[model samples]
Target: MRVLLTGATGFVGRGLLERMSALVNLELIAAVRKPVSGFPENVTSHVIAGLEADTDWRKVLDGVEVVIHSAARVHVMHEQTSDPLAEFRKVNVDGTLSLARQAAAAGVRRFVFISSIKVNGEGTPVNVPYLADAQPAPADPYGISKIEAEKGLRALAAETGMEVVIIRPVLVYGPGVKANFLNMMRWLHKGVPLPFGAIHNRRSLVALDNLVDLIVTCIDHPAAANQTFLVSDGEDLSTTELLRRMGVALGKPARLLPVPSRLLEVGATILGKKALSQRLCGSLQVDISKTRELLNWTPPLSVDEALRKTAKHFLEQQSK
Candidate 1:
């Protein structure tokens, strides 16, 4: 199989490249904005000016049977752009559709898109989880753009015979992780006391390896065609339980104070961190049964094993 992968320098993309390169039957093409170094021998790099609608992708799509679209404008807590929605849509919707159209014309067999779980909603009720077939309820600009891209991809698939597979993944964490997960790991590594003891909200998270595993499965699975699936680690964890387990992996105690969730919310609101608080205190579980049943796929690593690997990497990076 000849697969063209975008966002090869990103966390998830890096994981995919590392694993897919080892497959003897696969030839990987990494589409990156800039030059990437130290990739495997089986992988080829193609420099892209940007993921704009005008960017030409003829050479990248040549001889590619599958296109794994992972590049996009990720969500930011504070966006500096004047029109965040336009900026997000430029890459996530317009660029994505342009690429998919070109891929379809190039006779690409399958186009696998990596989308965000935020498309379902910000969070679900305590006991209710987000299902794969749920009506999209995008609450943010990023999620809205993803939903639009999914809709466009599906429409394109209907028009063309190309298979379109969409995988909506929750928070992905692993080695080289950054943003909120990295910050939390830093706090835990330094033994800073946290106030998440009262947070009992369950969240679904996917390890980079597990997500890559599913992407590989979708590339060849016949049933994955024209399907949108939610991917996760299968095991849900409360905020406190997550912190405690992470602490265990890092060989440290979870120095969490027993603070009320309401008090924490108020404090976060006063500190202009209401959104951050919600992420830490809200339930955003996903039901990934469709992915498992459709592809006969299961997460290769358990949550605990993934956490330990993440902790090891964080420590190594910190020591450097």
Candidate 2:
């Protein structure tokens, strides 16, 4: 079977590529916006000018049965413009539609779209779990684009009869990872005392390996068509517990001070650290029951295993 993956140079994409190295039945095609120098011998890279650019996408789409749309304007720091949503929509919404159309025309069997839990909602309250069927109430510009893309993809599936599987992953963590988690890890290594111990928030997190496994399953799972799945590590961890474990894995004493959460939140609000506080002290747990019940899939990695592997990667990087 032939498959194509966009954003193949990214952290999550790279993990998926590495994991698929043992799949002898798969012919993998990786797409990046610019030319790449090194990749696995089993995969070929195609540089794209734009999703609907003049270049012949058919060449890459040839005989490809699945398209994993991993490329997107990823949610990161700082608002770029007054109209950030418009910019995000161009790449996330418009670009996705273009690729789906081409894949449909090429008779691709399935299109697996990677979305974020942000598309569902940002923070969870108490013991409630975010369901796949939840109405999207994206909180940021990046999430708005993903939600728009989801709507477009569903329409494409209806129009072209191509199966579309959407996987909404929550706070993916693993080796070679970046963003907020990485920053926290760096701070932990530096032995900083974080006030997050006060937060009783439980958040769902997905390991890179677990997410990659789900992506591959979506490619062939018969029931995945026109369905959306919310994924995690199949267990949730409180901020204090998560940091303590990470500290354990790093072989460092976890420096957590049990400061009053209300006082901390007030200070963060005054000092323009609200976003950071939200991330460190918020809850967003998901129920993977739908995924488990339907595909009979269980999260194969333990949280400790995931955290340990991630810490090892960071240590290796520092040594380099």
Best candidate, TM-score-wise?
Answer: 1
Residues 100-143, candidate 1, lDDT per residue (tens digit)?
Answer: 99999999999999999989999988879999998999998999
Task: List the candidate 1 regions with Cα displacement exceeding 4 Å.
Answer: none
Distance (Å) between predicted and true CA of 167, model 2? 0.4
Give the per-residue lDDT digits (tens) of candidate 2, residues 1-320: 99899889888889888877568899999988898876889988888876532345788899999999898888657775788888898889888888888889999989999999989988989689899998888998889999999999999999999999999999888998887788889989999988877778888999998999898888899988889999999888888899999999988868999987777778999999997777677788899999988888888888999999999999999889
Residue pairs with colliding backbones in model 1 are none
Q: Compared to the true structure, candidate 2 yields what TM-score?
A: 0.96
lDDT comparing candidate 1 with the true structure: 0.94
- For model 2, what is the C-alpha lDDT against the true structure? 0.87
| Highest-lDDT candidate | 1
